[model samples]
Target chain A: MRVFENWDTSLKIPSMFLLMMSMALIRDQYLISLLPCVAAILFIASGLPLSLLLSRFRAPIVFLLFVSVFLVLFSEGDALVRIGPVVLKSQGAILALNTCVRVLSVITVGIVMIYTTPLSGLSGKLKRMLIPHILVDIGIMTGRYIMVIGEDYNKMKTARKLRGYMPGKSMARRFGVIVPTAATLLIKGFQQSERVFNAMRMRGYGSSAAGEARSYALERPSISSFLMFLATVTVSVLLIVLEVTVETA
Target chain B: MHIPDGMLPGEICAAGYAGTAALTWLCIKKARSSTEDPARIVSRASVMAAAFFVVSWVHIPLPPVSVHPVLAGLMGILLGWISFPAILVGLFFQAAMFGHGGFTTLGVNALSMGGAALLAWAVYRLLNRKSGERAILISGFVAGFAGVSLAVIFTGSVLILTIPAHIDAGTEISAILAMAAAHLPLALAEGVFTALVARFLLRVKPDMLL
Candidate 1:
């Protein structure tokens, strides 16, 4: 229920910024990946469960691996190994390796930012940072209703099952029910919005936020926090410069 | 149409984000100038965003992954000018919650997915002259197909521009081709589903189609 209350929530974004910049700058291998690797471990030690982390990353990671394989197989350069006519380019293999490490690193940074800090905190941060009011509202609404409408979907599926409607028969067959289900959910959403709008009106939502909106009273980053952020950014910038110079030389 | 993180260079990704931000601002301004109240659009947009996020989770297995109906045509038909922001919010949640896409690549994904919704809406508006069921069906099908296909093209453009920097030109070309070809089935499926949803919307909630 508490929003913008994460411990040092302000610093996460800077760290993520650094992580991402370093991720893009690194060309070759695991040296740059070590930062995020250690960060991920520290995140887990700080309390995010291993399963939660895996579940968060499983699909994208699988897709990353799948695409990297294609890159390794199809790319052209000096052949490192050959099995019959299919040649694995050493360059492609390296590219794939770099791709994999970059993905893992970025994904870790994203997980740390998103999981360690609740979205409410992020929203509050965005608000403080002067994001447009409507966009911020939309972001907050998305977090709220993803859970709400997701529950509605589960209930609808269950009700359909109880009515003896068999589930999807094939990849193609599911569209029959899914379309109507989506339609139903959308219509329900519209109807639900009316009540919500009315409730907000009754609660004096519009009038007060505008009149009293300027000061949100959020926890600003401390002086030490600012120094830490500066250090992180400097390190990342230095790493990127070092890698680029090395690559060119 | 989600571009996973690190698939494109940072500059390309930055460009995607920049373009999407501009589009978002334009959409918001357009929505404001339109007849319907902006607050009402926000409420509708928010709910639709939630719907988009939910359906994305209910994926039907295709091969290495599952493909879900984007329902972009439906969003375009219903939300009018609000579809882009709605889809953007949905993609944001998708990235944050499920890691279906990455945060840094979000602009690329949003422009692909949400831009498709905006395109679908435009197509529906252009084609639905008669307001009849048959017109709705045709418009919906075309909107859906074009939405998905255009999204693939946008994705391909990003990949084409970025992947060659990391891998060989041949591999990049083939990867783009393979991705475009892979989405054909999904596009066709989306076409059918969009028509169905549009038909249902027309029959049951006629006012919503406006």
Candidate 2:
């Protein structure tokens, strides 16, 4: 949870925004697609531990291995082993390479965003983007409650195990508690919100007061890095376009 | 699974993008009509988004690959048709934050998952189980499994429909078929997870279901 604690408390919102922007760019501009991945790598190299980045990458690599191993062994690349009537096309290797590169790119882009931004800052930005205030508030509450419910969940499991609630219990029976538990969790959560709201009201903190706090300023990206990012996106797009044109012709 | 960007074909991604936009618009319109207060509508939308946010990060690696909660069916039973926006937000965040799924395929993933949620709601209603608990679980399983399977079919179809007429139709068909076959287990896993979570919600917060 420590690895992810920073993720939730610090990295959630900004990374999400970056990811969305990168996704949009990847969809349309070929060059922009490359920037997030490259920039992410640079970010990791500068400050983040290389080991952590490598581990983040290891998940997709493992998944990719399963699919590609099948292709490499049975694939007909130059008829490497002519097993009776089968012919392995060299094209299979080419396809696998593209798939691997594509997956890595996607993973790296995600890593970059996570490493660079914090969640509060991201949500603050979204607030300015005109997403409904209520939704953001709910999101904040949800974040707070995940930890709360998660703690309750652990306690329940521990107590059950101590009392001999092991694997022998029916799957149906084991899950039976989830309903009431969720109900209690949410009702409590909602009740807490109501209480907090009322307390704020008593202290003169309601709709208008909350609105004033919402107008705080955000940190802008450094001008040099921003321009460099722009240039990288431009070059990457041009390269992709060149590749596509060459492939088509 | 969230399909990362660049892994999918451009035309297929475009179709997903367009389809998802239309669905979101429809969901917003429905949200407006269903609720009396703007705050209530926003709160309902956030519930789905919040559920999705937690679901994406709880990945349990089953060896070669990692899997997490799909929660489509659970969201459907708990939130009904409103699961659409919830799931769309979740998918959007997952792609953005975790890079689990790509941006281009957002529309397709949302439609596929949202369609499944709606389908579960319909099935649950058809069963007419007044108990609510049993109905929620059943709906969750059906919605989760069907959503994943249908999405695979949709993805394969997208690849086929746009693979250009001359690129050996047979090869494209075979490839998509293989991909679909490989995806069957993942769908079943999603169904089981959805059911478990639905049951959990039923136990912990029965009020959320309504």
Q: Top model by DockQ, which number? A: 1
Model 1 lDDT tens row, B1-210: 677776666676677779888988998888888734545656777877787667665654454456777766667777777888887787777777677877778888888877887888888889989868899999989998888888888878676666653465665777778888988888887787778888998899888785
TM-scores, one per candidate: 0.89, 0.70
TM-score for chain A, candidates 1 onward in order: 0.81, 0.61
Top TM-score hit: 1
Interface RMSD of each: 2.6, 5.8
Worst 10 residues of 1 chain B by lDDT: B56-65
DockQ, in order, for the candidates?
0.56, 0.26
Q: Report the lDDT tens digits of candidate 2 across residue range A1-249.
A: 232323332223334434433333332234434545664654554466667657666545665665454454444346444567765445455555655665566555555545555565555555665554544554554555456545655666577678876533454443344433433444554454445545545655335624643553344545554554555455445555655665566
Q: What lDDT tens digits, residue by residue, belong to model 1 across residues A1-249?
A: 122124455575756555575666566464555656655654664576678777877878787776677767776678899999888778777877777777766776677667767545565566665566778877787678878988999999899999987645675566666767878887888787776666655675545545334555445676765665676677667777777787787
- Report the TM-score of chain B alone for all candidates: 0.88, 0.78
